[model samples]
Target: MARARRTATRWWRWRRSPLRRRIDVAEAWVLLGAWLLAVAGGLLAGLLTTGTVERDLDRQRSERRESPAVVTTDAVAAADQAPVKQIGARSVWATVRWSTPDGSAHTGRTRVPPGTRAGTTITVWTDQRGRLVDEPLSGADAWLRAAIAGVLVAAGAGGAVWVGGRLVRVRLDRQRLRQWGEEWDRIGTQWGRKTG
Candidate 1:
């Protein structure tokens, strides 16, 4: 019962009260609208962003393909840079040659296992044009990216709505304060003369 009374009193601006000014009602409406928009708009934005990201990732998976390539030079001898850990193996940059479906040959530098011997065959990723490219994101990776993007976009949308509401509330408070000051001045003048 006490909690119910507290909740009811919390909405005093919406109740019939002579002390409740027009500004108070306007502020109440702004609060309600802001909350509604923040929830609905943020949800919509997040879903749209997530879907778009997922579709793009799916397209990448469809457009990229793996091809066999032969290392043109010994990785340990040709690689001037230190090996880096990739795909659970220490890799060094080495030139590799591959052929496209049209029997055309292409060579590009790619990461190969350290100490890879010349003429060793390795799998490499390539785009439709036969240019070397990074491996397409797996299903789990794509979902994680989409989820992160959705969360960030949702938070941004909600924050923007909340800031807009705060600005409106601040403006209303200033207007109320100005009106109070004016009323105080007018009433203070009447107090100069005694009623008795």
Candidate 2:
């Protein structure tokens, strides 16, 4: 049937066909290389990107430190601003004081629950200079964050590589088309120009 002939002609580059030209063989090789690059290169790039991301996150987790402190005074209760439907007690700035391991006193203003009274023992994280800082991420939270980052990095790297392969494929296809056109131009004149 016509379908059988179409299928037979489709992969002529992979078979012995008298009509197949040098360009056909070149295109087949180019396509094979493109596929290899898309798969192997993409995977390599994705894995490297993922490892780099996870290591950086681990470094950051190590750099951050944690400490405990106490609220110095009762936090001023925030005024209920009309037209604003607040979900929870709006946090208010309050002075909190804590001492270093050497008993050196330090104080800083930090957000506290509204109406929090002074002397309420509360723990607060601090930095190298004992400045108030957010708590370090827990182990589970860090893993979740790292996994999401890895997935995004992998997708981005793979997409870039896939696009590069497609560009190469398209260039090969254009070259093949131009070569076919040139061959046709040379032979068509033998048929009386336009064949009219």
Candidate 3:
């Protein structure tokens, strides 16, 4: 029991020393601030990203259900028939307006070449449900955009955490070293004269 009390008293004295106390408090604050900032920024980014994804999904669904038919077969429309746009060397899109079998007219854009005109008849493909699908994009621009955004967010958050930890560690190390030096000096003065 006496030994335990001595150990406790020594520990209390070391901790109550001014340098050690400041070091401990600074370390605690750094860790707390780092975690809090990360969590707050992560939540904000997640909410905005989720909303954007939902909106895009809704738009795609609507397009799939109501868009015009894309050309998939050989078509022979008049030279002045359809509004065509060149997407690539071999790909084109034509805006078409036609009446369905039930006498209801709908207009949509179709992917085709520059061969049809404004008033000519052209043969184009229609699915069983008769909805147009836009031509798919060829590159990875969409994925690249998302990846860049993720990297930016990660870099910002990681930098904050690193800086906070470094500051805390440096401050604590200085305080601990100073206190240790003082303790050694006191011990030497007390024992050196007695042993002499």
Winning model by lDDT? 1
Better of 2 and 3 by lDDT: 2
Which consecutive 10 residues in model 1 have the weakest lDDT in total?
80-89
Q: What lDDT does the true structure give each of the candidates?
A: 0.91, 0.72, 0.55
The candidate with the higher TM-score, 1 or 3, is 1
Residue by residue across 87-143, what tens digits does model 1's lDDT show? 545788899999987789999999888899999999999999999999999999999
Give the distance in Å from residue 21's predicted Cα in candidate 2 to where it truly belongs.
4.1
lDDT of 3: 0.55
lDDT string for model 2 (33-147, tens) is: 7667756766676677667766766766676665577887777533233245356756767788987666788999887777788888777776666677777777777777767
Better of 2 and 3 by TM-score: 2
* TM-scores, one per candidate: 0.86, 0.70, 0.37
Task: Return the lDDT, model 1, position 11.
Answer: 90
Off by over 4 Å in 1: 1-8, 82-89
Per-residue lDDT of candidate 3, residues 23-82 (tens digit): 566666666666776667655564565456455545554544333332333334422343
Question: Of the candidates shown, which would achieve the greatest TM-score relative to the real structure?
Answer: 1
- Poorest stretch of ten by lDDT in candidate 2: 77-86
